[model samples]
Target: MADLFFESIEGVKKPYIDSLQRLLKQLRSPFAEGDDVGIKLHWGERGNRSFLPPDYAREIAAWLMDRGAKPFVFDTTVLYSGGRRTAQDSLNTAASHGYTAEFLECPVIIADGMDGKNVVSIPAGYKHFPTVQVCNIFEQAKGFVIFSHVKGHMVSLFGGAIKNLSMGFASRAQKQRMHSDYHPVLNKKKCTRCGLCVEICSTKAATISEPEYPKYDLKKCIGCAQCIAMCPEMALQIFWNSDMTVFQEKLVETAAAVWKKIQNKSVVINALLNITEECDCLPGKNHIIGRDLGFISGYHPVAVDEESLKKTGTDIFEKAHPGIPWQRQFTYAREIGF
Candidate 1:
């Protein structure tokens, strides 16, 4: 069997769902009958217009059920204040985006508990993280289908299966640890003092008085980048505390740690459709950078993401987020034997 499987949407007479069905048929399943499988995916932030519909997730869940493996769709709470900051808010957002149990034919849940306390620390032994913390679902599900949306990300250049396993499964505190390397720096010339940044800030770090420019309290900032990504005037830029590559390395380390535990019974799939210039975590209509390609699947997150990047081409992401050392994710993955 091929190490990677791809189904392109070009010139196909059938609908995209058919294409995905064909792709699913090609991949080998590692699951045994009656196993509990977790279909991990992002359901888009509230008000985001570019996220992939839940139709694909329904298909994946149905496929697992057909194979006699019970499946559930899940995502973890995020660090930033938004529709997904709390488990209840995240589930509500998921339901709003059509990820409800009735719609997807599976239970939708927050992997981390209601208050984000259900978590476990796993051994990473990597330079950045000697141990990585993530949702405590590793023992409950016998298998996982790492379904990720392939799109541009401001810090990582692109988001794919690697990111899905890393940030997607991370606990709120772990997410903050990975994000702590950078903070928002304002470009006063571009500042409109609209207070949008202050409004979107999850932490009280960003503040403004009646007529003063917005001030960022570095001590209070958790570096979730919500302010930087949602700044309407594009006034905020990333201020890295160390080499920017450190962030990429930390991302890979976390994913590698999770992969180590789940590698035996996990498959990775990257949906190359939507190919937007920004992640679905941001709440606006992001610019589409590539035409709707299709899907790619592989046994490893690194390989699947690398293939997704190749299919989409690096230039698109580089142009979208210049000067990011995204390649470090792959190189560091190899170094740590992930």
Candidate 2:
């Protein structure tokens, strides 16, 4: 069993800096004097209304600077199209989201290639993967810290450290493959068709074949989860991760690759405020579930995520995301040596 350090949700609104400092010290970071620490953060979209506040990040960075490590905010641009897809777009979006020099003292770099293809492979042993893409920022960093906001998802039902890294470090083509699980064959019994799915699909993967009936072409689909999120009649739903055991095992395994490479040089912090129902990558935000769980930091990504999930402890979690068990992350992680 890995050592998991935790603290309760308090002081997020006031004296956040002190709370942050307390947790960082407990984790025993690799922040030596004059180290260039990579502060990996998600700036959300160009106009997201609920991303992590810049003042908190700024305070965290300043704390590190005072402690001898030079810190700068960093994030990879999106693989899918949106506000953070391009380098120019990322900078613009960061500034728009209120991430100014007054807060973060470093520049954000897209880990994979600038085009979302630059990568080095870290061979990994998992139920689903033999190797994982190690991004440039990840490969070159002297130290890493993931400042993630815990949240629910329209697809996965939860997004934390694992999702943050998988999708975060993923290339454009990798995203297409991961989303391949969303090609759900519509259950005709549940079908009211309603034309909502066809309207939402970007590649025209969904079409109306008859009145109150819709058909899906898996080949044409890009797996955007648009039809799944827009359907009102409850007719549009797919098998969640048709091969979930392997998919999630691979998810945790990939996270392990990152953690193992960094060893004690990395820290996972969950800023459990503004807990939204969907990932920041999504175009719109939705419901909030469970009371806000506060900051948790640990050297173990698996341990940190496991600790974070236990903090939620809600019944709606499994129903919100069927067939996907967050606990499986640890089971697989342990087998693969996270």
Best by TM-score: 1
Per lDDT, the best of the predicted structures is 1
Report the lDDT of model 2 for residue 198.
90
Q: Which tens-of-lDDT digit does each residue in 1-338 have in candidate 2?
A: 24566665575555266666666667665679887777777888866766777766776787677778878777775544468767668877888888866556755556665554466667666555566655667545678777777877655567778777666665543443455566646767877767777986789988886664688888898665556543544455544456665666656666676666676677778876676766676655545666765678776666667777777763456656665655666676777767
For model 2, the local distance difference test gives 0.67
Local distance difference test, each candidate: 0.88, 0.67
Residue 289 in candidate 1 has what lDDT?
95
Q: Estimate each model's TM-score.
A: 0.83, 0.75
Clashing pairs in 1: none
TM match of model 2 to true structure: 0.75
Candidate 2 regions with alpha-carbon error over 4 angstroms: 1-3, 9-15, 181-241
